[model samples]
Target: MKPPTDTDTLTAPADATTVENPAVGIDQTAGNFSYKVDYAFDAGTGLSEDTVRYISSVKKEAPWILEFRLAALKKFFSMPLPTHWATKDLEAIDFQKIRYYLSQGQKPKRTWDEVPDDIKKTFERLGIPEQERKFLAGVEAQFDSEAAYSNIKDIVAKQGVIFVNSTEGLREHPEIFKKFFGKVIPTGDNKFSALNSAVFSGGSFIYVPKGVKVAQPLQAYFRINAENFGQFERTLIICDEGAEVTYMEGCTAPKFSTSTLHSAVVELVALKGAKIQYITVQNWANNVFNLVTKRGIAHEDAEIKWIDCNIGSRLTMKYPGVVLKGERARGEVISIALANDGQHQDTGAKMIHAANHTTSNIVAKSISVGQGRSTYRGVVHIPKHLKGCKNNTECDALLINTNSRTDTYPAITVRGDKNSTQHEASVSKVSEDMIFYMQQRGLTEGQAMSLAVNGFINDLARQFPMEYSVELKRLIDLEMEGSVG
Candidate 1:
């Protein structure tokens, strides 16, 4: 198929007019709090190159990180537009027009109450604190550019599990931070990753000690309330030998006419006999660009899993990958995506087997409504030297309307005759008969459609922790209501 040639063009919205009142908190839905292109960097304005330098210099980083940033900046400047299976509509992103970072204070609050009232209100509206107060083992809340509040249970901390913001992890625990910061995914992996490396900020750093098992999951909440802005958060997780940890991230942004960017890089390392599970649920505004890179490395006898869901974004490009570097290592990815009216969601996963007796699995489901489009692009490889390796891949798509579209592209290479590989794909539409049956059962058309959509995603939801599973179901129900009618 010929590539799409029409580059997207985004016009700036009218200049923002906001009224500042010390008595009233910043309104998340109001334009007064939105981001605008400003030449000067001051207390009110967001982060700049100077701010990046300040962060690095304050950490007293080794010369290597600085050198890496300089090289990454060069790559970010020279890299051309991505033409591979992407919806060219995202080409209009104006790098110079965005504020790379925004924050209300200097450092992340050590205590929950230390967080500013305005930012706390934003989380309150989203029911974040309630989630933590109910069941989460720990919670980290990031507003705009930086984490405003971060806390871990005393029992978990006493068990030698390190949970904190990446910036603080680097400043206080340089010995461990330097060892695995970029080992899983290098700085020069891709253009957006390189950009994240050059100016990354405000993401989680987690380490689970040997022989320890965390009973409850840790969570992070990210919010973007500004327009013409980008959030570049960096996250890293290390599960030591025989340890286990589950991490979840949830995000939302307000609506805007102009485009915003969310480009982040995440890496995970699972050592021998360890297990790590990473979950991401993203609901961006209708006019934002979501491009992210996430990958993990599993050593001998280790396991790693990724559960991802993408519901809203003008354009999205994400592919989570895993590299099995040791005998009997395991990896799995289960994802669900929904695209609505003028949106495009392109997502998949990669699995590479470098040792004997390794296994991998991939299950992906996509829903397209209105004029939206969805695609599944993936790769699986087993080298000739490997033996007794196995892989299974499944891709499914559900189209809600005649105008919606879905595509699947899977590349599998198995050089060893002893290996086993399986691939299956299916595309189904919401059947009229099924809708009729539900309608006859005393349900409205919209309610029936929403129930069907939820059923399609129910498999993936089970992989999430109980609390997160409930939240994800609710979010999907809300999205379904808007499209069903």
Candidate 2:
């Protein structure tokens, strides 16, 4: 496809700020735009028990939830940064300097018409409304600390599928939400998870009933609008026996002079004979510290898969994981990451085989451009007791400059002779000769480079939904031009 033209831009309403370039991002990367608005509620700066209590009180949360948040705040304070294993850049995150919550204090509207104009314009510029109208079964748009709008298609809602933000799920569907919440990835799972549990706000909560299959995908969009702020959203999805669903999320934050934090926790549970597919595509500004933890559990004869794509951030450390807990369960992860100058994409996957005849697969590709760095760290394990378990892993990297760097850390352990596993890794730079040939054939250097990069990850990109895959390719093409610039 040729490069995106001016017509492809996403424009805001007359009153909201407009980004001339559709590629100005948060559409894909920079999320670089802003507008004026007044927040009715604020948790103020810094993290403490008082901050947590204020958040709980503002939400009118249950006493048990307040208790949980206070406990998590203690856990967060006691834990230290994982600089020993992770990058030292994480040490720069000043917990006390960040504002935990800022919102307009509006309940999520079921109709776009009821949404405040400013918030609605933000989502409009991001194409949230248009996309939902075209294909999604449900949609949620979150700005800073709260969801501004959330709606589900009538047909899908009639199927007994519950799609709402986390607050509603906890208060309205506690009988189901309480059991699975924090059970997959608890507060102590990591420091960031604890932080999220303490101040968590807007995120998608979906429950698919037994034997029900959602026909269209459900999508959520996350935006961070303020400076020196943190957005902590919690998402949980549960698929009952014989049910199936696909959920996707997109995130972006505008450029900030100071550091911004986007820490989130996601959990998924697939019951017997159920299937769940999760997809995330994030493009953040260089000021964002994108640290998130996502994991899923697959029960007997169930399947879980994650399709993750990362494009921009100052430093990103995320590893999506899956635990195969019953006989014949399956899990898979497909990932693509691009790191530009002054950015690091540290990402991978983890798979644990716990029962007989389980299987897992992982495929990851990275592009390092102009001194950018990308690392792939993965773990796959099958204990000696598990028989006939199998796993396959592949990591590939493409460098666009001599200074670009990539690393691979694969920890694969299979104890039983009955288990089988395979791993493959490759690293290479962009071929100057191919770029010259494409230029000779009437392609610009940027176009040629984008073509080469797209070729390297096209097969993996196709794993996304059809329209989204096309958009993914466009995203790559646009970012390749920026890398060259």
Candidate 3:
């Protein structure tokens, strides 16, 4: 098939006021868009020991990895669905009906032209290549369960930084990979995490050498092309002592009549005096169920931060977390979630203080439109022995309509003396009077609403990279277009 042109992939909604300039390339104007692709190999529907073995065999994984997969598979089957969680829709996922893996069965290519046409076109629409050329130091593009393209700038690679798909990282850097693999986030941490461990496919593995500071960000983009499929990507990032690195990831899937599943496990490790920033922007189709487990460990004087934005999905339950394992370590979480129509976004942060003189912060914002529901669930723990520990958590929700719903459940356990902690939460609605005030200035109701919502998350949005911030604002504007009557 001929590769699709830019015009073919990007379809602007009729009501869209802004046409995304290709220069900035992350197009927020494209609405519920998708293309067809043929898979070279597909592990037929259902999950079992056979399916796990098939996936491992296809990847030519090492024996140890295979053993891990089998053990995790057993755990997945034994574990029950999280019925007590905020998202009751967990009962709707039919694990037996979803394809465990789908891939083109090709090694990652360094050049865009060498990438499969259909897959290339998909990333082209998302502007992955262009973004790599402009700002990113390294890029990995995952298409339906595997990385189709992975490359790093020669200059950065020469600096002793390793950025590759998890498959290659396991094969090439077993020593480093094994030391921290599943150490931060164990396979049995949760059911979804176990599922990801059992059938994990393409996700990025990054290692920054000691004392090296990567000035530019490394990125991975995941796209799901098959229907009724389960995408399980495992990502691990390690920052050595005195090292600093920033990594970003984005995901999207086609609109399918039947539900699709995305379950991923991400683990980050920051050694003594190191720093790591992990960012994620997920815009899955409304029929997709996104359940993920992400956590990091910060050693002595180290830092770890999670910047997350969730926009589109039938249901999303993710809590990016951090463990301060060494004295003076720091962690922060900045999150923004928007639930529209029939969607539900359940996301928050977890901070576990295991040492003295540690600090943690969490700032979360959510917007609910139509009948959508947005929830914030978080946990902060400080043991009795820890001193000089501090925590601050703030959660705010914005309701667009009367039917819209919002909930906040924060669990804070503090047993230490001389440790300071603060928690704040507020829920508000867009008042007619505010809209009228903006309308008096000749702005339409939709524009006013968009402006209001943008202002609500402006602080958190500013925390995003410049390019992403622009696209995020555009997406918010698009979501606000028809929000009000």
Candidate 4:
């Protein structure tokens, strides 16, 4: 595989302003890129009891954590790769050849200058620090298997909001960490979940105090700088009663001849009257298999929302879910996926209405180019005892080439007489007439295709924060560069 070229480098002005309109012009040069870095420690390759013990010892984790990891490892080995469905290419993953963990010995730096030069340059190119200074209330940066830099604004910290890496949070606030860790999504939920639980490393841990609202979003960036490696980060977010917070995460990896793995587990808790929003923009290299499990619990009158955008990966299977465990709880999932040549993005959402008067919504958009494929698998359930429950799901797919493919599988179960459920799906190809019309207006075919794709997800993109929305548009344009003849 070739290293990233200059054209792939994502460059932005230090003071770049966010664009509000999707149709408006964006910096076409802004794109995703990757580079390699040296590591202080590498767990060689393969998985075993010794590997697990080595990881635990390196982190100096508690005895209980070590026990939990060993148990989860046993579970992972006992289970089989998903053979029922979506198993055609999953068998290709060579577990024995993949490195489980790799990291530098440096602790997370509070100041930019303290970060290692190579890692700092990588984050600088990604604009993590600049975004932190401009709008983010806090930022955590992970390179390979550990956090490299973490800092929260002083004012936000003074407000009693705790934003730190998972390791620190567990070491410093065991009371709060132990209460919710693995509570939302258990270790044995699935094969990938078990794998993550066994080898999880650096991820964000946030706690919003009661009644405090974080006006600005907190951000985290994960970069896989090594080849043929796996990144397993565990994230947990807890919101106390009457508090509100929004968190966003981004991920990327370098192109490699061999496959890389990214399996993460994210759990969220929304207490009574609290609100939590989680957003993710995953732009991995085509040689990466991105499998993740994310779920949240919403208490009475609380809300949980997941805004997900998937752009590149060899194969990605993720479905963020929410359990409405209290009356009047609400859950929403807004997603957009783009699959170019040789890529497969299978993504969706799940909503379980366990309480009366609960509501849920799912809106998904997908685009397939060349021989790429996109699939949407969703589930919404309202039991017989639940009353006044409502669910609405919509899935839309756009194919930009003759070889592009898409599939939709939505299973909705509503047993209660008073509950209501609605599902809508559409599959369409880019119209040549629209391309011709745009070309007549002095735009290239590629630009026309990009514009049409952008228009399809314009409404949903508006739901994202301004900065991310702008970056999403630029990424779309970049993907559409060679889509059309």
Candidate 5:
């Protein structure tokens, strides 16, 4: 692919302004305060050993970490860009111009009072603090390139649950961090994973010890306020024997004229009898390219579940997967993707049953409107030796306009006769009759469209945390406004 053009090199100013709490008019509310990045750090284009070292140096990382980055950088250089089911527009990525490592302040703040007011208001508007207090066992909020706030409720912390920003975890809990950091997702696994290994920053690290169960979900909110900066968050979660935990991540980027890049790596390890659920709701701006890598490993009798929703982005290519490594393990993935004008949402899941009696289920849905395109590409493999394994996959696509497009590519390989596997796919469009019927009930075109779309995604939405589910509905409703006649 050719390098990004000169026009793509221009970085727009950060759009971190605090909008008037929409409920209150600007006249009645305090003036908007936003953080704008004045100085730009140019992390030259392309993957190189020198670039990796620079990123590590910026973080003041130890020697071993630097070595790991360099190795991953080499892998990134050697790996070929995926030829199938990849965004052709990725040629627009100006690697040289992306600032791989960025920190607005010196260190992550533990107290809200110590955080920059603009950043605080930004999260406050998103109800981060409120959600943390109400439903989360812990919360980590990352603004731009680094986590600005990290907090875990006292009771949960006292339960031997370890929830902290990845950086802090690395510095303070080196033993645990070293054991699992890249074990689930090795640096050389893929191009984006390698890229994340080279320049990752500001993600959550969670460890649920043996026999513990976290009643409340752990939440992490990632916001990109800077223009042309890449956010490479590396998240790791480990649930020891008989433990259970649920993790939710929400991400949004401010509007930008030029595209920003977000390449993240997430790894999960569910040991014997452990259960984990990972949820992600991403609402990136139209001028962003989101390429991410996420996977989990489940041991004997363990379970892993993924709930993903993608609403906005110029181009998004992500597949959250799970590998059942021990007997009787289970995996599940439920996803919904919506693409609107000039957007492409390419996402799905992967399941590899490597042991006896393993089971997996995947349900994927996509909606395309205007000139948007949505595709579901997935894989399910149960090797010949894996006896009594079972898998089920269902993909559904809805196109809202004639110009919109949706496609599904599911690859399933079941080699043993002892295994039972099933796959189903369907494509549909928003019916004019349905719209007219809703209109006859006094609903506007936009409202009808939004309602129909919500109905299609209602099942997946219910899987989200209550607050997230409500917020997601509001966001969808907002995005649907004025979208239809």
Candidate 6:
């Protein structure tokens, strides 16, 4: 395990963490974990008003929702691919070739033991049930297009916390769900947002009551187990005045030659003096495309924070944002992205300082391996009318080899003299010298590489929960295992 010398360059190598060449029955990760579900409800293939109607009718949604879906369908058709500023590869998406929805047409079981055997086995393999029992106050498990299991701890539920799937929430708690359903992220926010609105299904809707603090995090897991399928889940979370809550989501999909699409829209609202933290860790097979839109609004003295990690997708474009709508509101985004061979990770954050004394921060780090590419596209805005507004942005990229690429595009507009902002960006390759030095100290090249990569993002990783931070490091190590070639 000799380390490369100055004259010997280490180009990017294919990632070994994901499964090599996919066969018809193999998943890219989780030890070939996948389910052969027999969905009873299918919206057929493609995107059309009919397809939208089918999905709405199957859900037996209210007339208003059907109207919303129809309107969003029109918008999805009217909007062109956002290739002008985004990657042109978006054109590869063929709405006609993708299935809009697929479901077992069953209600989510409240208990894990009550879930279907096949679905339960899938979650058991993913360790979702165990995680929920150990550390989570609530958990929602969605398989493909519908929730297979959803439950909240009794103690937490008794505190007036409402945690349920979006459909259930809308049907059972309209007064609260309707008030903030599409407020933070409107249907027209983007093409994908429109698409999600047109046929969204199986996502979490959470409401934290005033002055109540959730001691444990609420969790959601989204699994894609079918081929040539599209999953669009819409999640909405609201925290009343002086309330605090944390929600974490994990996503994964099997390896499919035909490709899978995951387009989701998440919206959050934090009332006065409330705090909300949203966390996501997505690891899709290289055959899947992950496109998402997430945004939040922070009211007076409220705080919003987004902790995002992206890995293992053919392409990913996500930008979590926050609007500081009231004075003394604060926003923050901490992001980590790793792109391996044949993968592209495009991620960043957005902050809108709408009131005086609003503050925001963004920290993003990306790793590119093999022929993988990574990009950081961000936006920070402070209006001229706002006073005492401040923003800070930092983006750092790590290139594993000569063939990997990284880019940073930051848009910052601070109009008032009273506002202050700082922006910093950097790109660097893994240092062979450091590897050699560590090798001299008896560390193998792979270990050395993993150590360096971990150190690069250690501070951000530490911000995650203890369990998640460990998992994140383990994934980083898996990515490095194949880089030494």
What does candidate 5's lDDT look like per residue over 1-485, in tens digits?
12212221213333644354433211101212335653233344555666666656656677888888888887887887775548668878878777666565336677677766656767776667777666677889987777888888888899999988887788778888888899888998888899899888889999999999998888898887766779999999999999999999988877777788999999999999999999888888777899998999999999999999888889999889999999999999999898888899999999999999999999999999889999999999999976999999999998887899998889999997999999999988898899899999999988998898889888878877777787677667756773665
Q: In terms of TM-score, how similar is model 3 to the real structure?
A: 0.94
Candidate 1, superposed: residue stretches over 4 Å from native: 1-63
Q: Lowest-scoring 10 consecutive residues by lDDT in candidate 1? A: 1-10
Candidates by TM-score, descending order: 2, 3, 6, 4, 5, 1
lDDT of 3 at 237: 96
Pairs that collide in candidate 4 are none
| TM values, all candidates | 0.89, 0.95, 0.94, 0.93, 0.92, 0.93
Instruction: For candidate 6, write residues 162-232 as lDDT tens digits.
Output: 99998888889999999898889999999999999999998999999999999999999998888899999
lDDT accuracy of residue 336 in candidate 2: 95
lDDT of 1 by residue, 1-485 (tens): 11212322222332334323322211222212433322211122343455456545543566777776667777777777676646677678877677775544346776778765556656666677777777888899777667878888887898999998877877777788789997888877887898888877789999999989988888898777766768888899999999999999988888877888999899999999899999998888778799999999999999999999887888888989999998999999998899888889999999999899999999999999888899998999999988999999999999887899999989999897999999999999988898899999988877887788888878877777776677667666666677775
The number of residue pairs in model 6 that clash at the backbone is 0
Clashes of 1: 0
The reply for model 4, stretches above 4 Å from the true place, is: 1-36
Candidate 2, residues 225-298, lDDT tens digits: the string is 98999999999999999999999898888898999999999999999999999999888888899999999999
State the lDDT at 6 in candidate 2: 23
Error of 5 at 304 (Å): 0.5
Winner by TM-score:
2
Stretches of candidate 6 exceeding 4 Å from the true structure:
1-28
